[model samples]
Target: MSHLEREIAEQPQVLRTLLRAQAAPVGAIAAAIKRFQPAFVQIAARGTSDNAARYAQYLMGIVLRMPVGLAAPSVHTLYGAQPNLARALVIGISQSGKSVDVLQVISDARAQGALTLSITNDANSPLAQAAEYHIPLHAGEERAVAATKTYTAELAAVALLVTALADDDAMRAALNAVPDALDATLTLCDPIAGWAQRYRYMPQLACIGRGYNYCTAFEINLKVTELCYITGVGFSEADFLHGPIAQISPGFPVLVVAPSGKTLPTLLTFLEKLKARQAEALVIASDEAAFVHAQQQMRIPAATPEWLTPITAVMPGQVFAMQLAAAKGYDLDNPLGLTKVTLTL
Candidate 1:
């Protein structure tokens, strides 16, 4: 097995470790955040970590009822503009905790009076040192270039952080089931591997989702591009409808992550429209209704809470990307020009 596949299988245990070990630290950080009572939240990251931040954006917005913004690091790194962050909670997420741009943003936020926090695997890395508070991912060492365990570990940490801030026991309790759900997701690999062979020569594809799963779309696209070398793009369903749907034609591959949630009705409508366009859809859904429209369907565990779906829903996409890369005769663990730790200014 390639390192990527092994790392992919490690996710459930990584999540378990994160939940068990980080609870006390995250709770302490949550108490501090509540005392600070930031008016808004800002997150800075890149690549896979950025996708995790996108998940956190939706999570913090929905649960805390606070506005969340994804920081444009270039604004600080290049433009040298220091915006007022006096009443903001700034979070920097990096698997290695060594991204220069992420660390810079956290440092600047702190200088501007924001409460800074870091979520990372390396507790002693520069990013951890830069932030006022740190939540270690406890994901251990991840060597795969495509990043499997760290991505989910970051998601778990974000979920825990949000739950801590809200002090929502129900949400906290819901997280306990996540590891098992992830374990069950691994069972789809055999079927997904078979399905992925059809897309081995696929030129390009689209990944679409909405609300909480929107970030899943982006993460899936990233994996497909990085590992499978396919020109994959991710879109929010609303954005796809507005203009990009023109790019779709007969037999074009479109992957949709439509877990049962508040977003289901609109997603069903969108699926119907895709059917009308003759666009081939490979759907990841827990809803039975989604199977009728999709050319291929991968069912995740049923009734996964919408807020918690991001943690469970992303696994199939990861599996598909890995399998597709192998089918294409590409290296899974080492992509041509990538490394485990990427530092950018």
Candidate 2:
């Protein structure tokens, strides 16, 4: 195993601690978001932050019934916006709050009259200093650059924030129990890492998820690209069958963050198509339907409320990425050309 992999393997205990440590702030941030209640909510992040952006958008739309939009950090500062950004509530998420672009945009948003909030791991970082409110993930020092606990913590933090805003008692309960969900997901680590090590060289990998796990699919692709430096894509299962299936052939590996909702029938249909194409496939799910089979499988504990399966489903994938990167001796702690924070315009 690479140094980063060893570091990650040693991290679950620490991660569990971080998860327990941040519950209050997570809840508080959600409540703070509700208080803002601006004309609209704007999210900014590059790469993985972009993944987080998608999750934020999904949750706000799916769970909170709010309209959430995405904006790159550059647009608020350098790109020039047509509409007044003055009343928009912008929440910029960065693991390290100091990236040049992120900082510039937070300043621009403020100058235009928007309420800016920074969700970061470092409260002392530039991005955190620029925003009016800071929701630190409290994830502590992440040793490997390819984020693991920090990203999960950020997801939990966002969930807490949204739950607070929408008076979602059910979601609030989910947030409280998330660490347990995370633990259940971790149990699949050995199996997932085995897959990663075995398939490290597989060409053209695809990941699919429906509903909330869609964001998890995005995150898995991000980890693969950043660490293993592979060409990977995350798509909705149904959408993939429509056009993307042409790219899948023998030896191509696919990952499905199988949905637990009504989408299961659709997922199984897509799986059949994948089978017909003779492509390799992996599925992550918890449903105990009367029938189930796949080319490869990683099962997480069944999560409550079904749509929240992403909370549990993403753990093994993160571990899988870490192990694959470790096998290649890739630097997981600090991925090439990236930092803990991006203070952008």
Candidate 3:
């Protein structure tokens, strides 16, 4: 197996290891955050980590009721602008703890007396060292140039923090089922391996999702672009209807992530419209009703908490991207000029 494929297969075990080891440390951080009582939250990340941060925005907002902001590293790194973060909880997330700008954001937030935390695979790396607390991803040495396991590990780390803060036993139990859910989800790779051949010549596509899975759309698009070199765009269901829907014509390809949740109804409506326009859509949904509106369907495990669906729903899309890359005769483990760690500013 290629490094990418192995890393992808390793996610279930990686998450299981993380949940077993991180609960207590994560709980301590949660205790600290409760004591600090920050007014809002700010996160610093880039690339795939940035997409994980997007999941944080929705998860923290809905579950913890804490407003969250994505930091523009340029403000601190290039323009030298220091926004007062004293009353905020600032978080830095990176697979490698080496993103210069993300590290600078954590360092500055710490200096400004903000409660700072970092989630990274490297516990000894600089970003972890700069933060007041750290939650190690425990995803192991991910040799894939395109991240597979680390991205899901990041999502789980964020969810672990939220579950710790909530201190709800039922939610904790729900989280324990995630590894099994992921293992079940991985079976989609078999079907994707065959289905991807149909899209071998697909030049471009749109990926759509709403609510928590909004991040899934973008992250899946990133994977497709990285591995298959597809010109893919991601959009929220509403955003696509507003203007971008005009761009869709008969036989246009669209990929969607609409698991069984509150988001499914509206997504079904969106798919209906796409059907009217004769778009060829492959929808990832757990609901039987949703299948009626698509040319193709991939089902994930049903009843995954809406907040955590992004964690489970993304796996099938990753498999599709991997298979699609193989179908197109493109590099999977190492894309054209990409590297595993990217440093900015």
Q: Tens-digit lDDT track for model 3 on 176-247?
A: 889988998888656777778899998998999999999999999999988998799999999999999999
| Best of the two (1, 2) by lDDT | 1
Note the residue pairs that clash in candidate 1: none
The runs of at least 3 residues in candidate 2 whose Cα sits more than 4 Å from the true structure, single-residue gaps closed, are: 1-32, 80-83, 288-293, 329-345
Q: TM-scores across all candidates?
A: 0.98, 0.88, 0.98
Candidate 1 wrongly placed segments (more than 4 Å): none
Which candidate has the top score in lDDT? 3
What lDDT score is found at residue 97 in candidate 1? 91
Candidate 2 residue-wise lDDT, 1-345, digit = tens? 444555444344544565577556656765665666687788877667667777888888876677788876556567765346677778878888766776777778877778888888898988899988777777667666677666776676677677767776776676667666666666666776565678767656798887777788989888887788888998987688789888888767888887577777788877777778777777877775412547677777766556556666777677777878777777777878876544444
As a TM-score, model 2 comes out at: 0.88
Note the Cα lDDT for every prediction shown: 0.91, 0.72, 0.92
Count backbone clashes in candidate 1: 0
The candidate, 1 or 3, that scores higher on lDDT is 3
RMSD of each: 0.9, 2.8, 0.9
Candidate 3 wrongly placed segments (more than 4 Å):
none
Candidate 3 local accuracy as lDDT? 0.92
